[model samples]
Target: MTMSRRAFVKTSAAASLSVIAASAKAAAYPTRPITLIVPYGAGGPTDTIGRIIAEGLREALNGTIVVENVAGASGTIGVTKFYRSPNDGYTLCLGNWPTFVLNGAIFKAPYDVTKDFEPIGRVVTDPQIIISRPDLPANNLKELIAWFKSNGDKATQATGGTGSTSHVAGILFQHKTDTQFAFVPYRQGVGAAMVDLIAGRVDTMFSVAANAIPHLKSGAVKAYAVTAKERLGIMPDIPTVDEAGLPGFYTANWHALFAPKGTPKPILEALNAALVTALANPDIRKRMEDVGQTLPPKEQQTPQALTQLLKDDIATWWPVVKEAGIKNE
Candidate 1:
C-alpha cells in the first residue's frame, strides 16, 4: 500500500521527534563519575587548575569528577585521549593557550581541535610579563628594546618550550620592536627559567606574572612590561607593552573548558552554568588573581566566544609563526 504525502510527512516528523526524545532521555547524563582530562604532568599549573575546576563541577553536578593527567608529546597525547573519548557529559578536557591553539597548529595531532571537541568556556586569562635579570642595564620595555637593537641577537631568552605561550610572547616582542634574540628552549619548568634569570644566565624571559612575581618581589628579577591591554591591579606601577612604546602589543595565557564533541546540549549548558557560578565565588576569584589571572565576563566566556577567539588566534599567530621561522620541536 502507498502512503499519502501528508501521511508520509507526519510519519517522518514523528520519527524525528522520537529520536529527539531518545536523545534527551539518554542525555539525563552523569549517572556515573566524570573524568576531566588534564593534558599536563601532575603538579603542573594545568593539573592544579583542572583539579580545582573538577572539584567545583563535582559539587555543582552532584557527581564524582576525576582529573586524569595523560601527559606526553607536549600535551597532544592527553588532548587526543579526551577528543577520542565518548561524547557524553562524563568526559571533559582542561586546555590552555598555545597548548590548545598553537600546539595543534604547529605539531602533528591525532584529532582536529575544531571538529573533535566542544568548547564550554574559558577558565582564566593570565598575563605574561617580560622580565630581565635585576642587574641588567635596561630598566623597562623601551630600554630593553634599545638594548636588543644595539646588541643584535646577543641576548638570550628562556621558555618552557619552543612554541609555548611564553616563547610566542617573546617572539611578538621582537617582532614589534624589529630586533632579534637567541631563543633558549628549556626542557624544565618555569622554576629553572627563574633560576637562570636570577643567575643572569638569560638576559630576558617572557613568563606569567604569577611565576615572576615572587622573584620580582625578592629583587632577583625585574619586570620590564606585561603583555596585557592594561596594567595588572596587583602591579599597577608596571606598564603594559602598549604604554611602553608598542601601542597595540597585547597577549595573554588563557585556559578553557571542553567536552568531547557531541556532548548533549543540556550537559554543555549545565557545565557553562557551573563555570559561571564558580567564577563568582570570592575564593575562586582571589585564587585566580593570585596566579595573575582574571575571569572573563560571562557573556564573552561561552562556547561561541571561544570559537571566535580560536579563529582569531589562528589568524593572529599564523603570521607570527611564519615570521619567527618557528618549527616543531
Candidate 2:
C-alpha cells in the first residue's frame, strides 16, 4: 500500500532526526561520568591497577571516572555485571586473565570473553613472584623446591581463589616441579592471602609482582624467584625462576580494558585513544615500572592486540586447566 504524503514526510523526518541524535551522542561521547568496574576487591593488585588506569582515563578524557569493585567468583561476577550493562560506553570493566580467560575455561561463565565485550586496550602485564613467609627455610627457588619436596603435602600454598591467577600459577608450578602443597584458598582477593603469608599463617604463594613487592621489601615475605624470563629492573637482585633452576617456568598476569559488546565504534576509538595517552604519560609509566608492571609495546596497546591476546590466552590455558582438572568451587 502507498503511504500518505504527510505520513511519509513525517517518517522520513523522524529517521533523519534519529541519525543526527546518534551522531551527536557519539561526538559528545562521555557527557557523564563513566563507571569502571574492577572485578576484584579493593586493596588487591587488580584493584590498584584499575584505580591507576581510571585516574589516567579521567585525566585523558577530561571526564569523571568512578571505579567500582564488584569482586567475587574469580572476577566473573563483576565482569558479568559489565557485560549486562547498556552498551552506551558509559560502563566498562577492568578485567584480567581470571575474569576474561580462566573463568571461561574452567567454569560455565554467563558471558563469553570474545563475544560479550569490546576490547579497549591492555594497560599492564606483571610477572608472578614466588614468595613465602620470611621464616620458611627457603632463600631461593631451588631451596624452595627442595623444601616443598621434603615437606610434601605439609607445606601450604595460598591462592586468591580456585580459578584465580594465583591458583593457575600454583598448579603450573606444582606440575613443573613435581611437588604438591596443601592448598589454602581465599575467595575474596589476594589481600587476605598476603596477610596470611606475612603473619606466617600460610607458607607460600605465587603472587603478582605488584602486590608482593612491598612485602618482599619490608622483610615480611621472602622472595624465592620471579616467574619471568629475566629479573625486573625494579628488583634486579631477585633471580628469575629459570635462573633459579626451574627451566621454562614463566607466567604473567595482565590487565586490560573493555566495554560491553555493541558499544559505538567512535566511542570505542575515543576510549582507546584516551588509554594510549594515559599509558604514555611519564608519571604513569614510571609508576607502573616501579611496581614491575610492563606496558605493552606501542603496537600491542591497541584494541585488536588485546582481542588477539584474549583469544591466545584462552587457547593456551584451556587445555592445561582441563587436563589438570581445575574447577571453580
Candidate 3:
C-alpha cells in the first residue's frame, strides 16, 4: 500500500516524538526518590549491604534514594512485593543469594529468579565459611568429613532457621559427603548459633564469612574451609573448598541490584553506572571489606555479570535444594 505524503509526514513525526520522549524519560530517571527495597530485617548482612548501596546511590545518582526494609518469610515476602511493583527504575529490589535464589526453591515464589527482573550490577559477595566447635575432633576438611560420616546422626549443624544460606549449604554439605547430620535452627539468629559453637554445644556450622571472621581470628571456632574458588582476604589462612578435599563446592551469599523485568535498558545502564561508582568509592569499599565482604571485580560488575550470577546460582542451587527437600521455616 502506498502512503500519502501527508500521512507519511504525520507517521514520521509521531515516531520521532516517541523516540525523543523515551530518551527524556531515561535521562530524567530517578526524578523522584528511588526506593531500594531490602528483603530482610534491619541489621542483617543483606540489609546492611542494601543501605550501603543506597547511600552510594544517593550520592552517585545525586538524588534521593530511600531504603525500605520489607522483611519476612525468608525474604520472599519483600521480593514478591518487588516482583509485582512497577517496571520503572524508581523502585529497585536489593536482593541476595537467599531472597533471589534459595527462597524460590523452598517456597512457591510467584516470580522466577532468572526471569522476573532486570539486572543492575552485583555489589558484593560473602563466601560460605564452614566451621566447627574448637574441639570437634576434626581439625581440617578431610578429618571433618570422616568424623561426620561416622558421627552423622549425633552431629548438629546450627543455622538461622530453614531456607537460609547456612541451612541450604548445610544440606549441600550433607549430600556431598553423604553425611546425615541434623540441623539446629536458631530462632534468634545465627549469632546465637555461633555462641553455641564457641561453647562447644553445637557440632558445626556453615557460616557466612562475616559471622565467622571474628571467631576465626579469635580461635573461637574451628575453620574448615571457605566455599569459594578463592581464599577470603580477611582470613587468608582458610583454604578454598577446591583445595580442602571437597573440590567444586563453591557457594556465596551475594548482593545485587534489580528492577522489575521490563525496565528500559537505558535505565538499567544508569543504575549499573551508579552502582559501579559506589563500588569504586574507597570508603564504601572499606565498609564492605570491613565486614568480610568483597566487591565484585570491576570486570564482573555489569548488568550482564549480575544476570549471569543469578542464572548460575539458580542452576547451581535449585536442584540441590529440591533434592535435599529443604523447606522454608
Candidate 4:
C-alpha cells in the first residue's frame, strides 16, 4: 500500500491526536465515583477483600470507589452485572478462582469470563482448609481420608454452590483419595455452609483460612489440615497438605482486580498502576494479612501476570471439571 505525502502527513497527524487524547483521558480518569462489585454477600471473604481493595483504591486513585455486593448463582449474578457495565473504567469486578475460572467450566455463565474482562492485577492469596463437623471421628487428614473411603455413601460435603471453589475442591479431594461423598450445595455462600458443618448437618467443608480461622479458634469445627505448602501463621497448629499426608493436593482462593472488556489501554494501565501502588502500602498489606490473606510478590502484581494466570487456570481446570462431570445444572 503506497501513500502520497499528503495522505501520510494526515495519517500521522491523526495518530498523534489519538495518542494525546488517550493520555488526557487517562489523566482525567475516575471523574466520577467508581463501582467495585463484590460477587458474593457482605461479610464473606470476597466482600472483606473487596472492601479493603476499594479503600486502597480510593486512596491510590484519589477518587471515590464504592463497593457493591451482588450475591447468588455462585457469584454469576454480580459478575453478570459487571459484564454488562460500561467499559469506561467506572465499574470493576473483584474476581477470584471460582467466579472467573471455575464457574465458566461448571455453569452456563451469561458472560465469557475468559474474553469479557481486562485484568488489572493479582492481589491476594487465602489458603483453604479441610474442616469437618465437630463430631467427625477423624482427627487428621489421613484418618479423614480413611473414614471417607469407608463411609462415602453417608458422608456429605458442604460447598458454597455447585461451581464454587469448595465444591470443586471437594471433587478433587475425592479423586485424590478415591472416595465419594454427596455434596450439599448452599446457594448463598460458604458462610451458610459453614453453619451446617458447625451444626453437624454436613460432614466436611473446604473453607478459606479467613473464614475458618474464627471457627477453628472457637472450636466450632474440627480442623484437619491446611491446603497449602506452608502452614498459616494464625493457625500454627494446623499442618500443610504435604505434612498431613496428602502430597501435591494444594488449593488456594486467590483474588485479582478486573475491569469490563474493551476498556481503553490507558485506563487499564492507570488501574493497574493504582492497584500496584495500593498493594505496596503497609496498612493495606497488614489489613489483608490479618484476615489470613497473603499478597503476591511485586513482580506478579501487574496486568500481564494476572492475564497469564487466568489463561493458565482456564486451560488447566476446564478439562478436569468436564472429565469429572461437574456442572451446576
Candidate 5:
C-alpha cells in the first residue's frame, strides 16, 4: 500500500521524535540528588566505606549523592527499604556480606537477596580481627579460648544483633573452640558494640580490622588474631587465625553497591563507571588501604564480579548458617 505524502511525513517525524526522547532521557539522568542507603549505623565499617564511595560518586557524576544510615535487624531493615525504593537509579544501597547474603538464611527477610537488587560493583574486602578488652588477660587466641573455657558463659561477646557478621563470628568462634560466651546484642552496629567493649562492658568481639584498628592502637582493646588466611599489610604484627592456633578458621567482609532491580541499563553503567573511576584514584586507594581495606583488582571490580560473589557466598555460607541454627532475635 502506498501512503499519502502527508501521512508518510507524519510517521517519519514520530519515529525521529521517539529516538530523540530516548536519547534525551539518557543524557538527562541523575538530574537530582541520589540517595545511597547504608544498612548500618554511622561510624561502622559499612558506613565509613559508604561515605567514601558517596563522596567519590558525587565528584564523578558532578552531582549530589547522600548517604542515609538506616540501621536495624542485622541490616535487613535498611536493605528492605532499598528493595522497596523506586528503580530509577536515584536510590542505592551499600551492602555487605551479612545483609546481602547471610540475612536471608537466618531470617524471614521481606526481600530475596538474589532477586531484589541490581549489582553495581564491589568496593573493598577486609578481614575480621579478634579483639578483646585490654583487661581480658588473654594475650593470644589460645589464651582467649582457654579463658572462655574456664569462665564458661561469664565472658560476654558483643555483636551487632542477630545475623550480623559479628554474631556469626561469635557463633563460629564458639563452635570452633568448643566454648561459649554470653552474647550482648547491639542494634546500632559495631560503633555501639565497640564503645561497650572499650568501656569493659563486653569482654570480646570479632570486628572488621578497620573498625578495630583505632581501639587496638589506643590500648583500649587488644588484638589477638586476624580472620584471614594471611596477615593484612596494615597490621602485620597481628597473626592470622591459623597462626593463632585456629588452623582452619577464616572470614572476610566485603562491601558492594546495588540499586533496586529493573533500574535502566544506562544508569547502571553510568554508576559503575563512576565507581571504577573513584576506586582507581590514588588518594582513595591509599585511604582505603590505610584502613585495612583490600580493594579488588581492576578486573574484579565489575558488576558481574559482584554478582558472582553474592552467588558464591550464598552457596557457601547458607548451609553453614542453617546448620548452626542461627536466627534473628
Candidate 6:
C-alpha cells in the first residue's frame, strides 16, 4: 500500500529534523585546540593584537588557542594557509589592515577577501603616524607638503612595504599635496626604516602609532601629523593631518578576525562572543590603548558589520589603488 500525501509530508519533516539535530551535534566546537593564524611575525602590531585576543579566547572558551605565525610575502603566505585549511571552525585568522586591504588590491590572490573567508569581528584600530626625522624644518602637514615640493625627489619617504597601509597613506598624501617624493619600501618592518629616517637616509615616513610613539616621546623623531581625524588622547598636542592641512585625509588601520569559509554558524557565533568578551574587558581596553590602539565598539564586533566593512573598503580602495597604479611587487 502506498503512503498517503500527509504521511509522506510527516516523514520528510522528521528526516529534516534529524539532519538538523545531527548537524548541531557535529558542530560541537572547540572540542580541541583552535588555531589562530597571525600572518605577520611574532612582535608586529597584528601579531601582538592576535596574541592578546588569543589569550582572552583561552579564558572564555576554556580551550587552548594557539597563535601560529606565518610571515612571508607581506602576510599573504599565512592568509593562504587559512584559506586552504578545513573550515571546521578550528582555524581562524587575524586579518589586519593596510596589508589585508591594500594587498588585496595590489595582487591577484588565491582567495578573495570577500568570497574566501568569514569575518568573525574587528578587534581594534590605530592611526597612522606622519613622523619625520628631527632635522626636517616642517612641523606640520602644510609645511611638510611645501618642503616636499621644494625638495622633490631629493627627499625620500619610507614605508614598511610597497602596498602597506602606511605606503598607501603616503601615496594619498602625495596626491593631495601635488608633489613628488621618492618612496622607499622596506622588506623589514617600518621600525627598521625609522633608523634610516633618523640617520637622514629618508626624510620621513608614515608609521603606526605604536612604532612611532616611542620615537616621538624620546624626541628621536618628530610627529608632523597624525592621520586620525581627531588628535589621539595619547598625544593630543599633535594635530591631525587634516587639521594641519588637506581636509578629509583621515586614515587608520584595523585588525579583524576571520574564520575559514564554511565554519558552522554555531561555532562562528561562539567565537564572536569570545571576541566581544575579550575586547570589552576594561583591562584589555587599557592594554590596547597603551599601545596606541583603540578597541572597536561592541556593535562593530559582528560578522555582518565586518562583511559590510570589507565591501565598503573594497569600494573605497579600488579607485585609489587604480589611480595610484599599484600592482604586485
Best by lDDT: 4
Compose the digit string of candidate 1's lDDT tens values, residues 191-279: 56678888989888887766776677778888888888889887788898888877777778788999888877777888888887777
> What is the C-alpha lDDT profile of model 5 across 91-150, one tens digit per residue?
999999999888989889778998878999999999999999889988889999999999
Model 4: which residue pairs collide? none
TM-scores for every candidate against the unseen true structure = 0.83, 0.94, 0.83, 0.93, 0.93, 0.88
Q: What is the Å distance of residue 156 in model 6 from its true position?
A: 1.9
Q: lDDT of all the models against the reference?
A: 0.79, 0.89, 0.84, 0.90, 0.90, 0.82
Clash counts for the predictions, in order:
0, 0, 0, 0, 0, 0
Score candidate 3 by lDDT.
Answer: 0.84
lDDT of 3 by residue, 55-106 (tens): 8998899999989887667777788899989988889998888878888788
Report the C-alpha displacement of residue 30, candidate 6, in angstroms. 2.3
Q: Which candidate would rank higher by lDDT, 2 or 5? A: 5
The predicted structure with the larger lDDT, 2 or 4, is: 4
- Supply candidate 5's per-residue lDDT for 264: 72
lDDT accuracy of residue 326 in candidate 6: 77
Q: What residue pairs clash in candidate 3, if any at all?
A: none
What tens digits encode model 6's per-residue C-alpha lDDT throughout 1-329?
99999999999999989769746754565789999998866656676677888888888778899999887666778889989999888888999776567788887779887788889899888988888889999867788889999999598898767687778888888888898988887665575677898888888988887777777888888887888788888888888877887777788888899988877777788889899988887777777887789787889999899888888988988788988987766
RMSD of each: 3.6, 2.4, 3.3, 2.0, 3.1, 3.2
Q: After superposition, how far is residue 257 of candidate 3 from its true place, in Å?
A: 0.6
Clashing pairs for model 1 are none
